[model samples]
Target: MSTESHNAENTGSNDSVVETSNLAGSGDFLIVCEHASNYIPPAYKNLGLDETVLKSHVAWDPGALAVAQALSKALDAPLVEQKLSRLIYDCNRPPEAENAMPAQSEIFTIPGNCNLSQADRDVRTKTVYFPFREALATCLDHLQARGKSPVVITVHSFTPVYKGVKRDVEIGFLHDQDDIFAKELIKTFAAETDKFVLRLNEPYGPADGVTHTLTEHALPRNLRNVMLEIRNDLISDQESQQDMATILAQAILQAEKTLGKHKNHTAPTTKPIKTGN
Candidate 1:
């Protein structure tokens, strides 16, 4: 289904499920923020939760959109973002995954997601998940048609403390089976920044199912890709978000230069399934 038709059907006075910015940008980087907003449509009734929970990090990545927007502007790249709350349906996850409509996130329970019927799950997938994926796919297709091999960069945020433990790592570069690009970018960040702890998959890793978007969109196409997880506390304000985005943008540019030198890098042979659902 087309994005306009899906938005008309599902979003009642709310923003579109998927929003694209700088679509005509000529840069070689394509930014994606799967949990950009925490807005739930009036139809869901806040997913049967209190108003306070809807605004918390559990509902969405607190500063991911700000960093993504900054990076899009800095790099002159197109950005595809999800506008609905993850509580409705996490755009980053496969539609059939249990966490797609999470019954609980972090320590809070999602009352609306519990005991959902199959029909309800299907509706969520059809309305929110598919449209978001289709929009991103369309963006990639557009760039590819223009002879652009855009690097996919998915931005995310992590809580300072999870499950009662404090996380010392400030930034995490996550990857799936393909780690060449991510490793290069990590080396660049390590050499350039000494202000915060940088690590490979500290807070979340491939096992956490966080790489679904990268694997689905970038892996099959052999696009240089990585998922960046910044500490929410570090980017709690506009100034910090801009600062972090600058650092990340520089690292990405450096990595691109380095990768450009290696002309024979081969992509994986396993093809992704046609449907991310």
Candidate 2:
């Protein structure tokens, strides 16, 4: 079942935290992992779910965070991650989106997030969503100010089979309207192996009008961006996660080549800017 909204209450959780390397310099890429962790702060007591459930996809991307960490180390890039469960408040989703405050996520029921009032939602937006996004925008601005055009790569992982259906593709690129980055990445995967079939906008899409951070923030800067989805089964272990991270790192390197080919073409910018909390 899809969770459409979440109710909130007073909690002793810090809305945002920035995890980074001490090596501070402009890196060519800036990575963003919207559902980085499944951590429900000590105060929330796992948000009324089984502690084992905390480790499940309902609370976090099963293997995506590991892939992101491997990619960050391999690429020497700064990664901006959401510290809490997406169930608490999805960093990728717009504040007003239905799933922005999910009543439930995956198989878990969010006891703290059922039948929320508008005021509760507003507090969540202020305390959780805004702060992380604001940090992202500020980081982007700082990098740009330093003359670094960071290529935004969002890493996420999906369950291998949902509702008992098997998936064939190992990786997918999620995007909307602008296919510049997605198309190039597809070509890279195609050339790499027949076993590797990259799906364009498969698994997820931005067409339904749910706001995602990449489309909202990075796209406006004319910054090259793409959302990557890896099947959870492929990266369920450390070895596999590293392997995919290497694959993605190479693909992004190839995408840089393709972007150079289309220097004359660029997506037009849009204007509804919101301050990240």
Cα deviation at 229, candidate 1, in Å, is 0.3
Model 2 / residue 45 / CA error / Å: 3.4
List the candidate 2 regions with Cα displacement exceeding 4 Å: 1-26, 208-211, 261-265, 268-277
Alpha carbon lDDT at 165, candidate 1:
88
Candidate 1 lDDT trough over 10 residues, lowest sum = 268-277
Per-residue CA lDDT of candidate 1, range 1-277, in tens?
A: 1123237256674557888888888789999999999988888889889878898889999999999999999999999989899999999999779999999898999999999999999998988988889989999998889888888999999999987889898999887777788889999987788899988876788777888998889887888888999999999999999999999989899998988932245565653322110
* Residue 209 lDDT (model 2): 41
Worst-scoring 10-residue span by lDDT in model 2: 1-10
lDDT of each: 0.86, 0.71
Q: Write the per-residue lDDT of candidate 2 for residues 1-277, one digit (tens) a residue.
A: 1111112234453433334331244457778888888867666666677777777777778888889888777777777778778877888888888678788665557887788899988987887787777777876777777777777788998877765677776688866546677778878766666666568776666663433877777777877777888889889888988988887788777777767733244665545333221
Could you estimate the TM-score for every candidate?
0.93, 0.85
| Error at 224, model 2, angstroms | 1.2
lDDT of 1 at 64: 98
